[model samples]
Target: MQRVRLVDVARDAGVHPATASRALNPAVVGEVSQATVQRVRRSADKLGYVPNTLARGLRTSRSYVAALVIPDITNALFPPIVRGAEQVLTEAGFTLVLTDTNSATEVERSQIASLRAHGVDGFIVATASWHDPLLDELATEGFPTVLVNRRCATSALPFVGGDDQQGVRLCVEHLVGQGHRDIVHLAGPSNTSTGRERADAFRAAMRDHRLSVRQTVIECSAYTEQAGAAGAARLMARRRPFTAVVAANDLVALGAMDALGSAGVTCPRDYSITGFNDLAFMDKLTPALTTVRVPFTEMGAHAARRLLEWIADQPPTATQSMLPVELVVRGTTGAPPVD
Candidate 1:
């Protein structure tokens, strides 16, 4: 059998090829008559004519493609998130382009420029920093942008993340209730909202619970296993030893666990440890990790939806959503062992 073309379908449907093309595009669905649309659709089905997305988009000024900007795709936490985003966008007939800048600002800038040159319909940026100049420029340039799992100091952009304040409160309350009054929080860099907010929440939660934390918080330069190990070591070097450690991220917590192991310490028995994000392998560690579980997949789906809205020129109201978190009780957390 021979392949079908738009012209062949349009001729059978008693419409122009351009009219048939518009009917096939969801973005222009409203402009065409429903009866005519059904006719054109039937004709298309009979002919099995594949719509040329590139050609149609040239006529309609749409690419039906979105770019996802990731800081570090190698992180285990990102796979599920990307899967969720792609699942949603795929249903909407939008192609998702995954780009990693390795968390480098310069690389991110160049990549964003390249995506713009390719004419992406919008962007879902998962690498937002506190003061992201590239993000601001993109937003100001009127490109539809959705920030996933991070935020900027300025609230002009749509942001999605876990409830940091609530998650921290729950974590601190759990630690204090477990008889861990001397707890250390392994924090991320203060430059990003997740790091800054979680750190501040830790301080507030500690104060609210009347826990006396005698040591300074350990802020890792980046959210990586190596950084976590280094940061945990620094906290241990201080003169005072805390009975528990609450890590800002799972990698950091796992790193802290490694550091403790290297120093001949045991978790829950020697010092209770808790982590955030409940990433993969948390439960399979030497002692299962007790960490907060944030809905990474949900955040990704929400980001996809938000980006679609922008592509449709129906941007959501500039707002921030803080999803709920669950604290998983595992082997890593327990009552402070008797000295």
Candidate 2:
């Protein structure tokens, strides 16, 4: 079978080869007239002509590929984010590559270096820590990078994430409105921005409601069910008198519930609880989870677009994009159990 060439496509589209070339390449397609670009694309499609990305990369010094770095691939919370970013990148004539680093800094560094060596154009990172040295290094090297769902404290890189502080405050406010005063917070690791911001927000919200700011924050080692279970168990060991638990995320919330149940405690009967990030099937749980809904898909889409803009030399003046969140009321939350 004869491979369809650019000249044939140009001829079929009734345009010069140069015009067809510009039309087919997304990076330079904007230079061509819209009508001509459409015509050329239609002709290429009809002729089954595939763009030679390798040859084009050699000429333009760009692979037209981007990398998305995530902390864990197994987490249900990341699928929507990946879907959103993939759609945007695919429409823009770019390939999206996904890599998970198991939330390890050394693994993240190694994976990033490998991706860069492979000639990926830029990165959309969701694995940044609060004060990541790798992020600072990437900034110093002038890499085209955008952060999602997390941000580095010292790096100047642009970030796209949900309003974590607002989410936590909303959770606290909702629980307080339900007549729960002595609430404890199950927090993620302070090394990450999401953890720090949400923990701080919980404290501030409690203070705003005139609740005591005592030793109410129990820090989890990670944002996993195991960590959450251990944290909850540790909290229970202290025999703290609390009526509600504000978990860092849905997984943590579920773990806390499991731990409580093991000790013959049940949600909303013995204690009310709320979680952040209304992950899939939260409503399907035995006792439906009440949580804060962050726009994960929107965050991913905006982060991809922002990374593209930076790659196009249109750096955003704003350092951060904080999407809004909503509080979802469900069966897990209620007025504090009658004493």
Each prediction's Cα lDDT score?
Answer: 0.86, 0.92
Judged by whole-model lDDT over C-alpha atoms, candidate 1 comes out at 0.86
Taking all chains together, the TM-score of candidate 1 against the true structure is: 0.89
Off by over 4 Å in 2: none
TM-score, one value per model: 0.89, 0.97
lDDT string, candidate 2, 157-249, tens digits: 999999999999998999889999999999999999999999999999999999997999999999989988998999999998999999999
Tell me the RMSD of model 2 versus the true structure.
1.3
Model 2 accuracy (lDDT, Cα):
0.92
**Which candidate leads the pack in lDDT?**
2
Error of 1 at 145 (Å): 0.9
